[model samples]
Target: MIHCMTSFAQSERSALCDTFLEVGPDAPTLSGSWRTRDLAAHLILRERRPDAAIGMFLAPLAGRTDKIQASLAQRPFEELVDTIRSGPPKWNPMALGSIDEAANLGEFFVHHEDVLRGVDPAARRQLDPAEQKALFGVLSRMGMLTLRSCRVGVVADSPGYGRRSLRSPKDEHGNVVMTGEPSEIVLYLFGRGEVADVELDGADHDVAAFRETNLGV
Candidate 1:
């Protein structure tokens, strides 16, 4: 059931892979205290190994996932990075078209940002117009699921990119509106709101509730 590859997503993935090699394995990432080596191992395991990938999202399998990732991390840095740059193996679902595009675009894009943001919050890449559209397209379809934890309705407005509600039926605190560029919205959706250059409008309590709730996976 793998879908078509999104051109923007694939391009971003390729760029992320290249950057990983350039920065070296020990470089720090926005993933808490994880470095590039940990991120590289994560990509390999998530894409190439079904067991490991499953464990990543399932609490019961998380320990197993960690062990496999640690083992992969122990490999020679150059070798591990090269595998990521080469992309997933052909037999892997991630090697398929749209599935890779939809699944990896955010993973790579966010992780790519994680690397840069970890070093400097001001260091931001200029995304292409099409890339922005692609991101919003993906968000439009998945925003609800990503923001399911919100007790209040959350409306996102990104101008040319269109708008969508991450939640519906205003909660006790009512609805909150988030305004920003699509890219900024994407970052906020992925749990980077504190530093994300987005504006919130609504009651303080409602806004806080929206911000505090888990926004994405």
Candidate 2:
């Protein structure tokens, strides 16, 4: 399991890197405040935070809603890529120490999917169920399901996986019944994007509303 998680992270990192490369320096801005450039910059900085590296990642991200615009305003894309490719200055020995391998797998895979959304459908379709489940478990623990204070329930038709739902423990009626592939559930829970591939249903008017709000966010 440990080996597989590590391999998954490495694969996700590679895929993210490839996506960044293909985005080039002039990719259009994404809907809302985030753009392709911003997403790339965020990913690179995220990988080089306080525990590692000594580049502009630590500089002020505040007041910089337009991440891509801010990045381009400061430096060119090639320079930024070169800096990121150089790796962090100080690797965190305890970065992945406190958190289990499952958490790390979740971070890499989910973030990879976020970057790939609307960019490469085929590549996004290659995500593994096991890896996605690991990610979903992490997000659930992180309280990501509390978006807009709305509760959601999800059910999968796959065998062995059984039926699952996302709810506020206190709520009786599951707001949303997320039924579909496991990957879609993971993506939906993490707020990476909409679950276009999944079939969501339930006595939850909030589900569609949540989807509407999140799809463009």
Candidate 3:
């Protein structure tokens, strides 16, 4: 399981990095208040902070926004990518232990889409099924489907599986119905790109707002 999860994360990291490389320096920033550049810096900062990783499972909601801001002055994108490729400063077995493997998978999966959406949409098709399943399971747990508080929803069109809502925020109205291949839905929910190609529906204003609000620690 550990090996599988590691491979999954690496694949996602590669895709995200490639997408970032494709994004021109002047690419339009994401529509939300926060830009994609901020998200990229945040991920790199997280990988370097040992304390954050150790406490991430228990305090996943803590310090993320601050960490991103604090690391804004980090080295250029090229240097950051090289550091990430080198791996986390010190891998914590406990951190992975606190969260289910599926949850960890979801983290990388969603974040990968987040980065890709802000940068390059064309590369999104590269993600694999194992990665999508991991993200789908996590989004469901986060309640993204019911259009409640979740920002994304998954509509299962396959036989034997009734349509189910995944993640959204509470007090939210309307829905982002993600239909088509499960992989596409997973990528879209993670913020990879627009879901116009899928059978999804929802108010763009709400999603843009949710994306703007900082949810990380």
Stretches of candidate 2 exceeding 4 Å from the true structure: 1-4, 28-33, 47-61, 64-69, 72-74, 82-94, 97-104, 120-124, 142-148, 151-162, 169-173, 192-195, 204-217
Residue-level lDDT tens digits of model 2 in 7-54: 555566556556667776545432235555565565455555433223
lDDT of 3 by residue, 172-192 (tens): 454455555555545444454
lDDT by residue for model 1 (164-197), tens: 8767745366878889877788888888787678
CA deviation > 4 Å runs, candidate 3? 1-3, 22-36, 50-70, 91-104, 120-126, 144-155, 158-178, 187-197, 200-217
Sliding window of 10 residues with minimal summed lDDT for model 1: 1-10
Better of 1 and 2 by lDDT: 1
Which ranges of candidate 1 are over 4 A from the true structure? 1-5
Q: TM-scores for all candidates?
A: 0.91, 0.64, 0.56
